[model samples]
Target chain A: MADKVLMKGNEAIAEAAILAGCRHYFGYPITPQTEIAAYMAKRMPKIGGTFLQAESEVAAINMVYGVAGAGYRVITSSSSPGISLKSEGLSYMAGSDLPAVVVNVQGGGPGLGGIQPSQSDYFQATKGGGHGDYKMIVLAPASVQEMADLTIEGFDLADKYRMTTMILADGTMGQMMEPVELKADAVKTYEKPWAVTGTKMARKHNIINSLSLVPEELEQLNFARYERYKQIEETEARWEEFMMEDAEYCIVAFGIAARVSKNAIVAARAKGIKVGLIRPITLWPFPKKVLCDAADKCKAFISVELSMGQMIEDVELATRCKKPVVLCNRAGGMIPTPEQVLAKIEEVAGGIN
Target chain B: MEPKRVSLFAGHYGSGKTNIAVNYAFLLKKMGKEVTVADLDIVNPYFRTKDSEKELSEAGIPLISSAFANSNVDLPALPQELYSLVERQDRYAVLDIGGDDRGALALGRYVPFILEENNYEMFFVVNFYRPLTTTAEEAMEVMHEIEDACKMRFTAIINNSNIGNDTTARDVLATFEETEKLSRLSGLPVRMTTVTAQVAEDMKDVENILPMVLQEKYFDINI
Candidate 1:
């Protein structure tokens, strides 16, 4: 059954996390997603959950680290600049193999970019968000429902893999309202055996930290983490495909860009353009093999995004330059319209008159 | 190599052509289709095809753009490898040309001979309300300019007119009519027309008959 509740992406994330057994949440107030913090502030105390509006994004993520260290489900959410401050903490969490979720309701920026929905951070979030040989299981949500669903999934995957996960959302996804059905309450709780807590009965006090003073020890830890990453890549990659049966051209996009891209695809088809859409649900553990197969058949590829040209580099690497991938995009708070997308499609696949 | 179906996307700034090209490639990849996209636009500094590379690559779709050759810089020249792909293709290739007429001229240098030899379909994307092209005649004129510069016959038209989120099915239909008129007068077929999916869903009156599959080659189009 679907509940017709109109909730923004941020509020839905908070609620979803709570339902997913995330009792600890630490975050700072940031524009475009302040509603999430406010919602958590009101709900966490009543539900006996820990909600703390930390002094800074750095503090917020560190608080998440502390809670996750205690063998509990936890999370932190922030916008672009705030996310930048939390990068150090994110690296630390990844290094220590802490299971937690980080939600970034992306705003425009390199510095304090405007509080608008922008996929500019696509690279920052999909690639190593922090400096180190680490990866965050990046999930991109195109709608509010996905924001909620992916947040819960993020937590589950993080715990399952002992890795940090990030829900990479833009302002459009964070602020938009859509109908969603709440998952059954029975789906939330899980137990972890490899958790670090105080020494009890017959155990040693586990030290959960990223500090590796010895070079050899650090190298070995990094190798171990890479092995885990390899396993994750082998199993956790996910994506969505629409109307791709015998498609000549395909559009590759994620998050909100993907939703708009679908509209273009449907339109292109009506006009006799055989196009489809390949949407990546997970940014990391990228569906590389899936795309490679597409490359083997489809005539052309297009990468729709909201940045200058960051993701294009990766697309070139993935396809090995076998085909030409076109870029269609917008920036500075402007969302790409379906008509615009159609024009680009016409440019690539065929002409539209 | 079996020649790949190649289309060159050209429209006004902020018209969303890049978005369409990118998404088209993604959909093809999802359908287990092979695709390659080229970001040939060097004019726009803020928005380009390079933004979605990471997302696309993660999906196993390949991107053929100049962004890889020069990092922290604007693309000034088309890479040789990209030219070869355009000339003879074994994969689906879409060239995302820049916004202005100057951009089309820039593409002229790289694609004129190929366009003539391949008899590729060149779609002059028009947003009716766009500054110089509110009327069908104006669109025809723009088409002429592109055809002359590219040294190829302008074969078809794509009606991509819209008013952002406010676009409706009626608006799309009206624009499609105007585009059809232009195509008829120009002796070029209307290759395709685009309407917002939201509008298509809401109106329930517009009938879309064409299959959304990439099976028809250049000669198979009804237009």
Candidate 2:
């Protein structure tokens, strides 16, 4: 009821970031996610915010690192190839324990693969694309509405955990338009005690650096980061379960794949198949327990993805390989249709029963 | 009767211009008129009329887009096929212009021919529900910017003010006064207010209703 308006997903994310009190935005223009920078460029000037179109993806991400260390909510957005360039900054942000929001409007890629929508960056995003044993919390959004909602949540989560929170979306989610509500004004939810705000004469200056020369000190940093990651793994995993109460088969998917799978699940149900969906909204602290628990009730698991077979690995691990896991996918920017998914569902049902 | 030989839809970003242009082309085709869709969207990298090329081709409506249109290739190469939109007066041409003034620059080349022909209806698509253009004055600023950029003034206003898929009959009706205010402010007639087929039945009493089927954002069926 708060004056919903139609918005492209990338634009929604940009506006939502501004509402969440993000005063600084640095990003290079990239396909699919171009609107985010354009919107920020147009609106930021009017609202006393900084919108810098960096010379390169590396430059933009480091700019984010600088602004985030200054204790301001900041964001940067890019596609796959651009994200690759930002990987070094991502690792540094993680090691420095800086809280920032990163938006990956994913495009097809192994190396500048295509401009079409793709989820092939699953391994790169969740498995730590940058060097070092660091992790960034990843959230995948299925709808344009989710694109905005999760961006606001991304900033909050980043602040709460003091880590990089990545909103991993594909081109479809970036380009698609849907009715979404944006906050005119958002309340900042957390205080940054460890922020590198210039210390007054009364307090000790906070240092924000990734490098610790001492090997044991660096080892301790890694240990402490992973301990926090463990706490996140236990408490922060998010997912959506559809028709899962009495499911015989479970379809694990996220983003656009999950949306397509919903229709397939409904169609399969009409054809007398008891199939359900487990859409992981959070990819890093993946819904592992749900998958492991559903394995006891479900006979088979199917991963419907926009990649060749990336998330299927996580599905196998999360479910503890309790049942046969199949990959139903189309790579290189192609999306699986409801019919194709329904046929695959039928095939799995036929094989199991 | 034939509405106009060449119809150009221009507006603020997210004003539902491309979707309306697509629907208008199909309407012309359904009216038993030969139609062509010219996509002049060079502003945004995605969400262009070229996405419906297959359906339009199947419907016998030729589509003219950039050479790199619909590809991951981000080249903003304007298509040479755009000349046909200005030359062919025997058939209907529906143009989906890119958003805002920067987008309207693509229209500058064909403006002289279109003005000389005088057989065109340049529509200023307005959606008061959009974030920036929520008021008549704000919407007018976009109108003037587009006109200045293209050197062709809009002939009428198309009220496409709806909140995407969640739009209801009341939402459409709520914008009636504002659309009317935009019309009075811009000195342009309110051509028609579009409502989706889902809520069109409830909006029967409304005047100048142009009921439309929303854009097929997803694939596997309708274009």
Candidate 3:
């Protein structure tokens, strides 16, 4: 009661990262998530951590690469356009198997998008982020609590898998304030034997590089990386189901859309629509099995999103198109209202016109 | 007649200052005062008095925020409309200054006018819920920084500590000692302690209580 303090989602992420033993932070300022860098700037120096506002997003991510290569927990954050600048470094980190965390507090995108909440970066985060056969462990947090919790989870997952874990939150999550209880004492540590820490005349020097020119070697590397990704897929897919026991229709959403969908689901239920929600906490290793199971029982599925039906494709694939998956969305920073989503739910339930 | 003509609310980031400022403006409006809420926030890129623009406009209160607010301009430029706050002495000005010194820097230019008027009550909205200003000393450190940046010492305190949307009357009551301690340390009076309307009914006896009309969050956002 006394210790739980109000924190913006961005501040929660920053404090959670520090609590999770992340000491080196490098980032360029971008809206909706700049509070993270600002917070890090204020707190990092006092705790003997390095907080560098790099010359560019590119330089910031490369600094992250350097720190992660040295076996230290490090992070960098940016919005949509800033993330586009870090893709090359992200691919390099993936190619080198360097474990670190990246955060994309997404805004409306396709160029210099509007500085408003949008989940348009779904495909960019979960699918085509960097130019390689790579996948970031993308965690979508709907509330400020999850924003903190998942940042800790992201660091642990990155270390465990030796890859990049991304906290994919919309502008609402980044900007909104909530009461968050941050656990500062309990930090999980990992053994990074392959880290490029100094050998000190004992062990062989670890070489951290991504440029493997050999055809067969590069092929094996890709295969091996995918193998690790497959393990992650089988074990790590996470989602939340609400009122799903006898639901006739299922709503699939994540981040802010998931929060909005909850309101719609409750309203639809009151109207005898029998709609439920499956909110994915993990976007990359998406909760496909839940969607598949919902497809069996549910008559229809609605994909609620802040983009032009990006997650709908995943829903269709996950459900094998067994039940009709309709897209209920708003693009370019506009989020769908609960009334709009409830209308879609009623539409799916049987013409409640 | 109870409060001064000019009311300034400034504090640490996420200290519930912006919400408090908006609610205070509405209070002045309810009192049949000519109210103008000037959002002098140049640091934080988050929620501002701009969130309540439509409601304020409908209520006939002129709202002013950063010139580039809610746009893709990405600059921390102040609006020229800020001068109206200083120029119009008849209107009751409720200011929502930015968080900490960086945000309060924008208030420096207007400090001369506020001091010249000598009828302003600058409030340091204290929130212990924020990470940086948990202790009274730490809170005072930030207050000093804000005082330095704005060039005007806060004349009063507004204990606005609360968890967004989850604040209980018990939580508001628990900070009584800290608020008193802050008031004692800074030699400033505790003007009011704010709580949401839901909790106000339960704790009506609490002194100097200002029941806030909170902006409903995104979940309960009015469509």
Candidate 4:
């Protein structure tokens, strides 16, 4: 039986990580995400796990690097500004081919803008939150329950590909409460054959560092990561298509915004709008193939976000700009109400009709 | 930002409700409580608690809300945070519910789950000097709004009615009386009564007060 228990997004991730055998967590305090750190801080000690509150996000990410290098499942999370701080560590992890889980519970931002929900970080996450010729397998969770499920998947995928996985969430999904079935056996123990625990006799001396002085070596590492990414694209790209059958227009959104968008699609359909929703569950792989198929069927696409036209760019790219992609958004600690999204759908379908 | 606790602060609109929540969370951090405030204000954008993220974070009180949930950034989703807290045990969480019945309705969405998992006390902060302060009947109306909306009883009433610095013990008592009467009518309890320092020390007439302390984020609810 799937036990139903209401949980915040932050707590869901911790519980999921515990299920996925993530035994180490390093994080710093930042808005919209401190619950994750706080949760781990309390529970890790009881489970004989380590939860380190690093001095800053930068330090936290590096701490993740050290722990993950030891071949243990480790995770670090933060909001927009803090994610930016951890980018360097992310690049290092990607370069070293280490498995780690990173979650971005995004808030509104260009700078330290506001701690409101916004999807402006779409480009930042999919394009790479850090400076690198690399990609993190990013999963977009629209509900709190998914937050738990995906965090578990993130660890599994990371280990499978020797990759870093990120759960890209918006503030609403992070803060909202919904029933979830927590994974069992709060204590997670994993066997890391590659961990560098002082080169014990059980394994060879391992140097798990993200450094390659030669240009060709770095290029080879980048290509290897890309090949893994290609596999992810072929297999792990996921999305939910609602009422797309015989629909003239499709709305593309992710995270909590997508849930609200799905509700709007339902409302619009009730009003004879013939609108559909294409929710990209995996943001990094982008679900381009499904979207391409969706584009062939729909007249136009609407990119709904809490920020100005970030994910819309991807929609345009995915569809090869064959369809007109219109944008409707709100920013700076604001949520685009369901009515607002329905209004945009009405307008778009009016033009199509 | 701060420690995590399961708390909800509720009141009518324009009652300095958000301000009180923000300042109260700030004070809790100052007293060494690890607190995280959720701005579950889906109704209003103006006074949402997340507006003070920078300041609150600087004060060591991390704030999480609906706004921070996204796939691109690294904010902790509120559901994940809460569940982890329950799994881990002994963390403080505060939720700043909206101003009206709608806000309470929003809170109801999570009440059955969080309350069952972790025993939480919901506080209804009241200002006795406000428009509804004159009568116990009026006070019950607000409580009913919350009860109907949230589908849960307000565990306790935190009598916070005061007239700035001029507030007196008599005024506090009147508000407490009304809250008490409403509690009796509604079957909830007046868990604690808050009073200004000047009045707190002066009122030795009734000595066996359950337990009331300065209004701050990290105070012991058990005490």
Could you say which candidate leads in DockQ?
A: 3
- Highest lDDT among the candidates is held by which one? 2
The weakest ten consecutive residues by lDDT in model 4 chain B span B214-223
Per-residue lDDT of model 1, residues A1-353, tens digit only:
01233355787899889888888889998766776786787679979998898888988999988889888999899988888999999999998889999988877777776766688887888787689888989999887778888888988898888888999898777755544555745355557665777678678668888999999999999999889989988899999988888788888888888888888888899999889988889888787877888888788888988776566666667777777888988876556777888899999976422
lDDT of 4 by residue, A138-214 (tens): 89988777899889888877887787898998777776555566655433445666778785476678878778899
TM per prediction: 0.61, 0.95, 0.96, 0.64
Error of 1 at A193 (Å): 3.0
Which tens-of-lDDT digit does each residue in B155-195 have in candidate 4? 76666655533456775665656777767876776655555
Taken in order, the candidates have interface RMSDs of 14.9, 4.4, 3.7, 17.7
* Candidates 1 onward: DockQ, in order: 0.01, 0.51, 0.55, 0.03
Tens digits of per-residue lDDT, candidate 2, A11-80, equal 8899899888898999999888888998898889999999999999999999999999988899999999
Candidate 1: segments with Cα more than 4 A from true spot: A1-4, A185-189, A351-353, B1-223
Residues forming the 10-long window of minimal summed lDDT in candidate 2 chain A: A180-189
Global lDDT of each model?
Answer: 0.73, 0.89, 0.88, 0.73
Best first by lDDT, ranked: 2, 3, 1, 4
How does model 3 fare in lDDT? 0.88
What is residue A210's positional error in candidate 1, in angstroms? 0.8
Instruction: Summing lDDT over every window of 10 consecutive residues in candidate 1 chain A, give the lowest-scoring window.
Output: A1-10
On a 0 to 100 scale, what is the lDDT of residue B12 in model 2?
91
Order by DockQ, highest first: 3, 2, 4, 1
